[model samples]
Target: MNKDQVKGVGEQIKGKVNETVGKATNNPGKELKGDLQQAAGKVQKAYGDAKEAAKDNAKHKAP
Candidate 1:
């Protein structure tokens, strides 16, 4: 996977951990931040997926 994909996945995992911790500690702010981070990570991963798909399509179309 590319950097974006890797970073995105990492962020998602980190966010999940933070969310779980926040919930356990009764911290709404931390939970909200984790939710935001997870959302960003999903977007970034989608972008990376699109890039990879485009690259593959281009290769297949090459003469």
Candidate 2:
């Protein structure tokens, strides 16, 4: 996993916590921020996955 992947996962976990807290406190701002962070994390994870796949393909193609 790249730095983005690690950071993404961390962000996602943080977001989940924030979301739960926001729900408990009835804070829409926190909830929305959490949702955004989760989405960003997903995107970063996807990007890292794609990059890894491409790297693997390149390695296999190299004689």
Model 1 lDDT tens row, 1-63: 788899898889888988988999999989988898899899989988988999999999999
C-alpha lDDT of candidate 1 relative to the true structure: 0.90
Query: What shift in Å separates residue 6 of candidate 1 from its native position after superposition?
Result: 0.6
Q: How would you encode candidate 2's per-residue C-alpha lDDT over 28-61 as one tens digit per residue?
A: 9999888888888888888888888898999999
Candidate 2's TM-score reads 0.92
Error of 2 at 49 (Å): 0.8
List pairs with backbone clashes in candidate 2: none
**44, model 1: CA deviation in Å?**
0.4
lDDT of each: 0.90, 0.87
Candidate 1 segments exceeding 4 Å error: none
Q: Model 2's lDDT to the true fold?
A: 0.87
